[model samples]
Target: MSKDFLEHKAFVELFDLHYGNLVGFVYGYVRDEEVAKDIVHDTFLTFWNNRKRLDLSYSAKSYLFTLAQNYALNYLRHLRVVEVNEREVSQLLEAASDELAEYDERYARVEEKLAQLPDKQREVFLKCVVEEKKYQEVADELDVSINTIKKHMSRALKFLRDELQGESILLFILSNR
Candidate 1:
């Protein structure tokens, strides 16, 4: 009960007597041997640092048990937080993977439809849309009138729009919603 009870030699004796039991007590709460040992060590460190403030009315064994219990509970609470965050991050990764797959499928379908276009219409569409060329520039390159280039682009767009109208439209709307 005196300050000498918490001195180095007495503290070492206390640790030797209680360390295994404290680890077992903490393991009952935390369920991991390494974590239990760590918590027990931390408990003793806390006890040593706060030796002067300890309530002399309580036995050191009871005080050490209380500290170990608190440390174990805090570790469990932190582990739960980490598990919840890991689950959330896993779900987010799954959703992003699904979105990426969907985007790749949509891109492939658009590519297939582009390949289905007539040669002249496909050429005009690529030049105007993909290459960002003006109608007059495409017409001059192809040696055609600007009106002819316009008609080709218009037909190509209509064909692609009609081809992609049904499931693609529904998916777009549903995904946005």
Candidate 2:
């Protein structure tokens, strides 16, 4: 969008026209009225901030929905990860000292894989996976978009998976003995 298109009048018109629908779309995923509103608000804020670089030819409506959908999905993914980690932590706490050492070794091996990634990917992977920070928080800290963070994360995961594929079978064989 051009600077003129992002002026208050145009921006307000855009918001007034679609804000409620966007919120409703988000509500379908989150199932909370307030959270849906907040997500829509954040989406508009991002749109306003990135107005200059936004492609004017495309349907802003589609872009808005896509943005909200990604946010909703990220929220769901984070919740799932949190619940799984809680369960895993409970089990690990009940595990014996030998299991703790084994966990540490496995973690070290994962860390080595992370180190092989590019610097930005490694940092993002660690901050997001190890430090348990949200993608938005990491994006704000790194001065990038959530989309960029997601891209880096996707690439990182793919690289790690391919790199670990053979190791996984080898480790299974060794550990079973």
Candidate 3:
């Protein structure tokens, strides 16, 4: 076998040996299984990219844990931003309740429909609408591709449209509002 192939095999073995502990380490910080998995995946990506320069003397476990910790911290910062944005939108909606009653009712219905979506789609939709985050930002924060965000948003709109057909005018007003 070629030297490169041998090295790659070794890397795979090392990754398999470390993956579970790395995921546990990440979960300790992030407290979410999906997010922890993503962080561990990213750590592997980083390790692969830096393979030629990697210091074999340093424990692979240590490096993976450090990467996971950094990623988790960044994720927490993104969550804080999303929380602040949600609060701002909630305040705006509250302030305009009298003028936007019909619109708000339609929006409430749409939101109820949204809640039925799979978790990821619902999260993307809420981040886009209630938090006013751009699709790219939402995708990055969710560790999903931009195309996934678009698909989620498109499905969300379709669901809302179907559910709110009789209330078209109210829906349009709410969309604008």
**Residue pairs in collision within model 1:** none
Q: Worst 10-residue stretch by lDDT in candidate 2?
A: 168-177
Candidate 3 global CA lDDT score:
0.82
User: Highest lDDT: which candidate?
Assistant: 1
Candidate 2 ranges with C-alpha deviation above 4 Å = 1-6, 94-177
lDDT of 2 by residue, 38-81 (tens): 88998999898998899979898888889989988888898899
Name model 1 segments beyond 4 Å from true. Answer: 1-6, 166-177
* 112-176: candidate 1 lDDT, tens digit per residue: 88899999998888888777789999999999999999899889778878898753453233223
Q: Output the lDDT of residue 31, model 3.
A: 88
Q: CA shift at 74, candidate 2, in angstroms?
A: 1.1
Reference-based TM-score, model 2: 0.49
Q: Lowest-lDDT window of 10 residues in candidate 1?
A: 168-177
Which candidate gets the maximum TM-score versus the true structure? 1
As a whole number from 0 to 100, the lDDT of residue 36 in candidate 3 is 89
Clashing pairs in 3: none
